[model samples]
Target: MKIEEVRQHVTTPLTAPAFAPVVPRFTDREYLNIVYRTDADALRAVVPEPLQVEEPLVRFEVMKMGDVSGYGPYTESGQAIEVSFDGERGEYLHAMYLDNFPATASGREVSAYPKTAGSPKLYVDNGVLVGTLDYGTLRVATATMGYKHHALDVREAERQITVPTFMLKTIPGYDGAPRVQELVRTEITDVVVKEAYTAPARLQLFQHVLAPLADLPVLEVVSASHIRTDLTLAPVKPVFDYLKGVRS
Candidate 1:
């Protein structure tokens, strides 16, 4: 293949290309997000500088992507902390565990999402919305919420999901040092909220070596919601380059 042809390929033999090449869209995405308040000091310890933690809050999400445009169907579970970047309120994605390999590769390479191989299941059981995440044989997180207790405003739901999301992207250099280290920002646009509901919820994060979600420790369950939506992920843009001190 010519150099131009090689550059056009989205997926390499072993690595996935950047975000712009592969556009992923999701339809009828079922999400169950559990919001919790934790210790303020603990949150400040992990959240990076330049991103301010206004409240000690975290959103644990369990989602089932039914129809993905480019990648196939997959289930995902992750944790995002409420933070502010340059006076703009947003969420910083801490970690994600997914079952599909292609989605994992693209999510990490393209968007700098901290994705790893794991099993995440989100389903309804006997009228209860249930979500679970397991790393290998150990269960890391489990959440349950009442199914559709009350309706939620579609516009407010859209705003919650469409806000800017921050990520710490890193690539190793040839000498094993940091090559590309920057703060990536991304958001979902053209969101069509089909249905939204809220109900009482509970979350538990177990302590494990691989997925140490308990490090954050859920202090109180603030709220829970189930949302069905369709949206296209906007292209990733770097907001801060840690090594170069450049802003995009």
Candidate 2:
């Protein structure tokens, strides 16, 4: 897909803050990636299978300059991809990783997918890990989406699942280390039926696939900003402001 074409699909919110220039910027930085993640089961029921999952467990980084913040690419230790599964859950999993490549006088590119005239899409089977790019479009601009699904989709999962919360663990250090990294968790906050679906909706949650983090605290970054994976998790208070706050 063309980079400009995808940008046309979603609109940014007007109220969000603007990007500020980076302090002690990595002026020679290579490229940037913008990543967004939500639960799969809820997403599966809503979006058609093809786009039901917005890429898989790839690393997407957050960007920031000053007061404003947004999405960006990971400097190391991360990749991002779009993925989905059958309506029934049976451990069918898929993942994708993309490298960060900035736009040049010629064009922009993605790490795994090949470059097109401007923007490129995923090459599901046999995607290379290096030196490939797609002509990406549009620099990060401020905006929003309508009827956002920020809240986890719950109510509908009732009867299908019986647990209030569950946890996930990530492979520690990419080695057979004994580290127990945690991911998705579910909490039964409420049960409500969605207007789009007639059946009862359950709200089980998928946790932060990408670490809930900020390179700069109390600040928002722009899309394609670079973040360091080796970097420690940003500090958080008990308040637990998960999305754009200090990590608790």
Candidate 3:
């Protein structure tokens, strides 16, 4: 390809590109979010600076994307904590695991999302909605919730979905040292909530060396929600530069 043609490419040249050059958007996403209380100290230790903990609560989410703009479909599971940045309450995404390689690679390289490859499944069995994440043959986390127990308020759900999301984006240097480290923020726009519901739920996180979901122990089950929404994943912005404070 000519140099002028290379400039039009979306992803890095000569690298293995999984998804398309553009960012993928999801539609009619089935979501199961389980909110729970956890130890305040453990949360304080992991949560980065500039983002304060709103409460000792965390939300574990298992999402099944029905259709995507670029990539086809995938299932993802992760944890986010209730946090505030500059007095604005939002979620700080801790970690995420998905089965799609292209989605994982693009998410990490483009948006700085902490995406790793794993087996994550969300499905309805009998009358209950079940979500599970596994590393190889070992199950790491599992969650279940009642299927559409009560209708969710559309306005409130839309407001909650638009909240700012923070993530720790890190890329190692050539020598395996810290290279790029930033506190990235993302917000979803053009949200259209088709259906939502509140329900009873249960969660179980097993101890594992690689997947440590149990690090933030589930102290108490708070609430659960199942939602179907269509939204676009907006571009990420860095709110805090972690490397700026390093002494040269």
Q: Choose 2 or 3, whichever is better by lDDT.
A: 3
The sequence of per-residue lDDT tens digits that candidate 3 reaches over residues 44-139 is: 998988789869999999989999877778899999999998777899998899988878878988897888978989989989999999988999
Computed on alpha carbons, the lDDT of every model, listed in order, comes to: 0.89, 0.25, 0.87
For this target, which candidate reaches the highest lDDT against the unseen true structure?
A: 1
Clashes of each: 0, 43, 0
Error of 1 at 182 (Å): 0.5
Model 1 ranges off by over 4 Å: 14-21
Deviation in Å, model 3, residue 69 alpha carbon: 1.4
Worst 10 residues of 2 by lDDT: 103-112
Q: Residues 75-194, candidate 2, lDDT per residue (tens digit)?
A: 222223333322322111122222332211011111111111222122112322121222134221111212222332334223222222222223344577634332222222232222
RMSD of 2: 20.4
- TM-scores for all candidates: the values are 0.95, 0.17, 0.93
> 54, model 3: CA deviation in Å?
2.9
Model 1 alpha-carbon miss at residue 130, Å: 0.5
Q: Which order, best to worst by TM-score? A: 1, 3, 2
Give candidate 3's whole-model lDDT: 0.87
lDDT of 1 at 173: 98
- lDDT of model number 2: 0.25
